[model samples]
Target: MRIAPALLAAATLLAGCATTPMARTAGPANVPPGMQYLYGSGEAAALSEQAYNALVDSVRAQLAKGRPATAAILLPAANGTSAPGTCGDKPYAAVFDMDETAVLNLGYEYNDAQTGATYDTARWSRWEASGAEKVAAVPGARRAFVALRAMGVTPIINTNRNAAGAVPTARALAFAGLGDFKHQETLFLKGDADGKSAKDGRRAAIAARWCVLALGGDQLGDFTDALGTTPAARRRSVSSSAYADWWGRRWFVLPNPVYGTGLGSGWDDTFPASTRWTDPGDAASVAQPK
Candidate 1:
């Protein structure tokens, strides 16, 4: 109470600093699952690269075994048989989605999120056409495609980016140094009415002539047409079909948090916010086996 004026001012400043939250001495017990974008950026990139590398290995193994028929087919025609690549009747193809699987859409996504826009078709079309030059290849994608081509497998890109953007899309891939996509046929865009969104018909067409060795994309719809909008529906699709079992083996999925069915608004409605943290000590305890 009797402290000097300068001494009192110094003490007050110290008190303010002390009460302000210090840097966290320890990490949080657990990050909320809903905040994956905040915490899993690096994880997403790493997983995308890992998925491509694994697909390469899977294709290599199937080739060595001389059993292209054993490889998972993304789609089947009425006849239910394509010229298998193993028998040398036709070249094998590795299908991939263009947006987030082959190229990073982070730049466009960040711009859209800043403006709080959701799926502006015209805006997206413009972005796709003009923005390809701005995007970069997803990690390991160029190398993976080049490697596949070296192994006598063709790399086919099946994207929902507008059919008009096909030329720009190919230029974008080439800009990212993935020049292996020279033929327009290799880059199948949403040109036809049937191929705008649902890719089952397009994939089936490719499967008719060439053996599909593997497929890669960020969304479940990229692999097959048997997709449901809900989380339960997605899980059921994988569990119900034998072909869906080829997830890690023949279907390599990249991670995308910016846009996808994975971003759902029902989390808070389903699980109360109170469940975010149970106990501070529970973090280490829960990580250990019971």
Candidate 2:
């Protein structure tokens, strides 16, 4: 008879005490280093570039053909992007999320991961203190941004990384060779006087001036979340429109398993051994620190 060893093991462990890794509760100190590696990896950056190019092109084509007025990028990955916000008569504008979307914390992420470390605020500040840090623009991003600018489309940085981050973020953009677009009012934040995470409102504010033509980002919330967190709600929204196939087409999503809602529901969420590989026996017995 085929018996799952993990089932027996879980039964044995729970019988005695909550010793399963999944059951091991976290304390104040277990807040994790956090998955801060969304940026800096060569492969990830390359993918970001590819996504950027595809997105800008999609916007160009749509605008050139006079289709949708605005597009949106969603969240749960990096923040999303949208058609730009306007300044003056510039009706063509693009909205891109800050943080990992435009500029990445690559140096910090790479160094920390290489050492099995966590995100150090001091290091982060130091890295972002200068606008001259060696940051390579995501692949194809420079050309895309430049192309959009040539098309008279304005690009704005909309992010959740706080307005204070706007300066360094701007610097990083220039350092990456992505050139500087606009900051301040152009950089929308989570709690900046706006008092909202509802990007749709933010988009409306932008549209009040310029006509946004498209949007892109790594998450769904970047688009719109009229519905709550119900999975069915999200599926119906994206699947209902022609935008279903628009995932990699117009909505360029760079892979980001780190941070964002993709992680468990909270800081305490973790993977159970049973989640994938065969469950082990006396994980506590095997979990002894080396």
| Each candidate structure's count of clashing pairs | 0, 19
Candidate 2, 1-290: lDDT as tens digits: 00111122222222233222232233222212233233435666677777887777777777777545434433222344333233334466676765556655556544433443344445555655653486565556678778888988777766655456667767777787776655545666555545676566665666566656555565565645443464444546567653476575555666554444332232122333456443357687568654
Off by over 4 Å in 2: 1-46, 67-90, 114-134, 227-237, 240-250, 265-290
Lowest-sum lDDT 10-residue window in model 2: 1-10
Residue pair clashes in candidate 1: none
Best by lDDT: 1
The C-alpha RMSD in Å for every predicted model, in order, reads: 13.7, 11.6
What tens digits encode model 1's per-residue C-alpha lDDT throughout 205-235? 6666677889898778788766676766676
Cα error, candidate 2, residue 289 (Å): 36
Residue 252 lDDT in candidate 2: 60
